[model samples]
Target: MRAAAGKYRQRNSHAIWRAHAESASHPMSEISVSATSTVDERPAKFSASDGTALTGTWFEPSPPRIATTVVVIVCGAGIPARFYHHFARYLCECGAAVLTFDYRGIGVSRQGNLRKLKSGMEDWAVLDIPAAFAEARARYPRLPLGAVAHSVGTLLLGAAPDASRIKRLIFFGPHTGYWRDYGARWRWLLYGVWHVSMPAVTKVVGYFPGKRFRLGEDLPRQVALDWAGRRRPELGRNVEEARRFRLILSRYREIRAKTLVLSITDDAFAPPAAARRVLSLYPHLVVTHETIAPATLGCGRLGHLGFLRRPASEFFWRRAAAWLITPNVGDEPKTTTQAAQSPNR
Candidate 1:
């Protein structure tokens, strides 16, 4: 009986799935990692409920092991899908299929007039995220579906009405854009530039030329307004945004998934206070929070975007891979904070 119980637990642990994705059947798309392992990258196109065309790439483990689950890598605002390809490939190597895509008006999905595109941050949450979820479900009907969202991606995930379909979730450097939540060293600079300068310039130019300024990708007018305008004591910009705030507040309860929230210690946008605030929204989730410093990874900084830049062989990357395969042990939200020290330490 004890042996049987151990076997049951092992199955529940999701240990059965761990090799990264590949496709030997399609030699043209196969990426050889070593002599025996390979990952397959394939182009995918889907449409949001609003009928907006979206393009994505699928990284799948091939030959020896079929993926037991699908993990979608949700990008932060203004970040291209390619930024996550390395991480997706890492997850594929670890045994799950991964999908990474750009939101409308960004990366591969960008088209038409930037100033004229009606895709806002809200539209991304309501339409694009769900579309990705649907795409994953359609491809792997029996496999468990999960997501790893970065920065603003968490906000978008919580805002998605169909986000509950996700079996598991990981929010990296999660936070709402509260100016006060920024690190003191970068607080006012980020505020004056993102809020005061960017929004003002966005209005004047009809779109934010972030590509020119090195802030990030060029953004649609509404996306810039929706992001940069989230400030002061209240995050809502107007009556429409006030409604969205309330809607997202409630939808957080609907997204019932085992979540791991990873926050960097000195993340300018998502400090401990901000991470805690975002936690308040997800009353129904089984959340486990961890705060790590860049020093632990032997780096000088990991402020906002640096976490994604880190090599996938690192401890935190493996931590995320383990979480993707781990099932819920309980219903409680555990803020079991830990500082991830280097393996050398």
Candidate 2:
């Protein structure tokens, strides 16, 4: 089953690569990492709703105190929980209990003999996210529960109407308008990919090969398809079905939790302009916006992914830490114009 899945992913990835190659805008290369930078702490494993074990690590601050709050880190599409290790560790050291986990059918989650079919989408947003929330709440009932979601994770979390369980939400690089950014041809192609090709491919192959089939990476095909299909509507037949599950503009109003939206000025995926529009949807909610400039961080172009790649990304991490440690103080609204003109930290 794994071999079959691998083969499928290679083919699908190649097709996507071809699509990218035909475009003028070159996708950013995957970031390289130094061996010494790896966080060696072993993650504690917990069982999800289906008894699938989810892996995560707990970072305890020096002289551990009674936990005041707990923060669950939700990663973006196609990236593993480990990708946020540095940020999680930093939060843990600063006295906030942190939990980061992989979605079912992705990362270390057990892949049953069940072939990757059209059904995995139900598991990701419904089972994985809520289960993680339940597990964290179960373990730390007294502490305030908060969520920090990146990219599509934000969309998934935002799609949930009853966000009352979480006291606060920090959305890092949330994807607001993906379809608008891509060309009409690509949008149609993505639609077909998500609604038709992916479900069909998963049903036949027992898994989507887009990323999960990779040697070291454990990204699920369902998540990749959901992400990819947003661009090329032609590839997906059930665009309406996909849109129904999407974080529509109306859904933003239902996010009751105190929220913080963070966007880097150079983020290629979620530009600051689009992010500001997203922020406007949640008028009643307390929102704080900050822009990270590449010059301040001493990096050439601190694009979307670079915020995590460089440890010296103190501009983002420091502000994030301050926000977490400090109370209601950081939850204020900022306009896109203000964010742009504000001096770099």
Candidate 3:
């Protein structure tokens, strides 16, 4: 068993290395990472409920007014929290405290020789997200909290057991029915590859290289497994977990917080119809929806992940700032004060 595992590991590792090399040789020029402005503040590392240390940066509002509310930025599959740095800073500048963190066993938080087990989206919903939310609340107890989840993070957040902690929720490019949109054949093929083959391959090969493991880039084996096997609702991390994509559809009605759903018209991962379905689930909740055009934003045929990548990102941040600061009864009292103070107009 050990020898077989070793061989599989080596093969998968080599495959990842080759892909990484190829990507490096011909890097895509869609968005330049350095193009966006940087946040001057450095992130502080903190421990989660499971004792896993996580990295996060807190953005204090500009002009340092008394903070009215705080925003927690949750990134989607495989991405590090650093990708949301620009957005977080924009929220802070608009007078809302912002906290962005890397989920456990991914990004910089993967340090300390953590075990590489295959985890599903359910694990994130049950363990990582809840712990992160709890930590954010503990750290900023005095301030009302809002959450902005992107992609897979949206599913996990939407399924959270304690949605009351969040005053307002925003979903950016949420993945409502990924498997269906990708086609049944593709879904089955992925299931066979990721579920039946990947775990066995990973067991034999010590670790899968970063690039081949996309969703939670550089994700641990356990996380990858959870993501792959996350078909049945019963297989989710928490017992009360919403089972299946249909369950997610139904649970939206239970989300008590004011919500906003944002999607790009050209986003392949989340089409306009999918965004509409998500909103439809929450008819009673105060909801706002917007569709961004890539051409107008100077983003060429931008899709799901483009919102954070580059030149087009300015528009996304601007929209986010407006949505977050706009005074609704659900907004923090201080948010109203900060909006009034803004001299940008």
The candidate maximizing TM-score is: 1
Candidate achieving higher TM-score, 1 or 2: 1
Q: Write the per-residue lDDT of candidate 1 for residues 108-144, one digit (tens) a residue.
A: 9998889888778888988999899889989998999
The residue-by-residue lDDT of candidate 2 on 56-170, one tens digit each, is 6665444435456788888776577877877777676556778888776666554664354343444565667777777678778888888888866775665444455777778
Alpha-carbon runs more than 4 Å astray in model 1: 1-37, 311-313, 326-345
- Distance from true position, residue 325, model 2, in Å? 2.1
Question: lDDT at 92 for candidate 1?
Answer: 86
Full-model lDDT for every candidate? 0.74, 0.56, 0.58
What is model 2's C-alpha RMSD? 11.9
Ranking by TM-score: 1, 3, 2
Ten-residue region with minimum lDDT total, candidate 2: 1-10
Better of 2 and 3 by lDDT: 3
Q: Lowest lDDT 10-mer window, candidate 3? A: 1-10
Q: Worst ten-residue run, lDDT, model 1?
A: 1-10
TM-score pick, better of 1 and 3: 1
